[model samples]
Target: MRTVLDFTPLYRSSVGFDRMLDLLDNASRVASVDNWPPYDIAKIGDADYRITMAVAGFAQDELTVTQEGNNLLVGGAKTGDDSGEYLHRGIAGRTFQRRFELADHVKVVDANLTNGLLTIDLKREIPEEMKPRQIEIGQASSPAQVSQIDQGQKAA
Candidate 1:
């Protein structure tokens, strides 16, 4: 069973959350049956992430990884054909393209293809100005205290 959710009411009440709401809306509309070339995303440490995809029978040249803005695209295409005929073919070699939506400040650090597996590394690098910082507290003389000091000086 499939259910559709409406988010119009929340849209009118919130600010600075348009992207998050759009993501949620889009995810619900997308079909789950399009999943192919299985992949995994894991948060290995603070501000660090890893994505592993099973891309068997695909060469490094045939696969591509790209990141634009906050979106990541991974695609693979099989080129040429094997000469030998196979009576029983079980492996899949179809072309596939996968898209990943990344958060702000997240970047793709590296990607590697080995042993029919593709691994991508990502890190969220917050800007120095955006990071949380400590503010030093300083003492300030109140108006009443300053007046008291002035009166004491006058009496002296």
Candidate 2:
């Protein structure tokens, strides 16, 4: 049994949170998808993330990593021939495409393939204007206070 959450109420009362709602919906949808060429997502640093996928038989040329808008796409396609006679083939040579929805300021930093694993590094870079900043508070002087100071200065 699958339970669907209704976000109509949230949509009606919120603004600038559409992406968050969409991410929730996408997460629910991704739960039912097949886990092919298993992958792992880990956080290496405060704002750094890494995604490692097991691609035993895929070469660097056979894999592609691309980013479109707020989505990251990683795909692998076997280009070589499979005519070799194997008594028992255990390694999977199938093509796969995975999609990852990135948050607002997250970006792909680097990608490397080593030891039959494809690792993709990601980092979140918040702009200076978007980051939280402290504002200096200044003392406010009313007209009466200003007049009092002026009168005292004249007497002195």
Candidate 3:
């Protein structure tokens, strides 16, 4: 089921929230029926994530995993020997390429292929400057101290 959501009302009221609204508007336009080389995305830890792809009938050399900036690309190209005849041919042998958009500071830590599955591990490493930390509140200067400082400045 799909319904149109008009962001006109939000645009009229909200400020500095256009990016979030754009994301919501763009999300609905993405195709929901793209299920080639099925994959699963899971959050394994607070800042860790896992993307496991069911890549049966594909070899390690045939698959290529690349990370460029905020984008992750996973591609598989079946190499050599498709000449053999088959009756049923149930197993899929089509080449596939999937792209994943990663958040800021999210990096691909490791990737492994085992038992017909490809698993990619991602960890979000927030920079020290970006991570939330408590700011030490300092005591405000008293009126007496301010007046003394002003007097000292005048004397100088």
Tell me the lDDT of model 1 at 59: 94
Cα lDDT of model 1 by residue, 11-85, tens digit: 899988988999998888877766689889999999999999999899999999999999999999999687888
| Candidate 3 off by > 4 Å | 8-17, 144-156
- Count clashing residue pairs per candidate: 0, 0, 0
Residue 106 lDDT (model 1): 98
Alpha-carbon TM-score of each model against the true structure: 0.82, 0.83, 0.80
Question: Which TM-score value belongs to model 2?
Answer: 0.83
In order, what lDDT does every prediction score?
0.93, 0.93, 0.93
lDDT (Cα, 0-100) at 2 in candidate 2: 73
Error of 1 at 85 (Å): 2.0
Error of 3 at 26 (Å): 1.9
**Lowest lDDT block of 10, candidate 2:** 25-34
How much is the lDDT of residue 155 in candidate 2?
Answer: 100
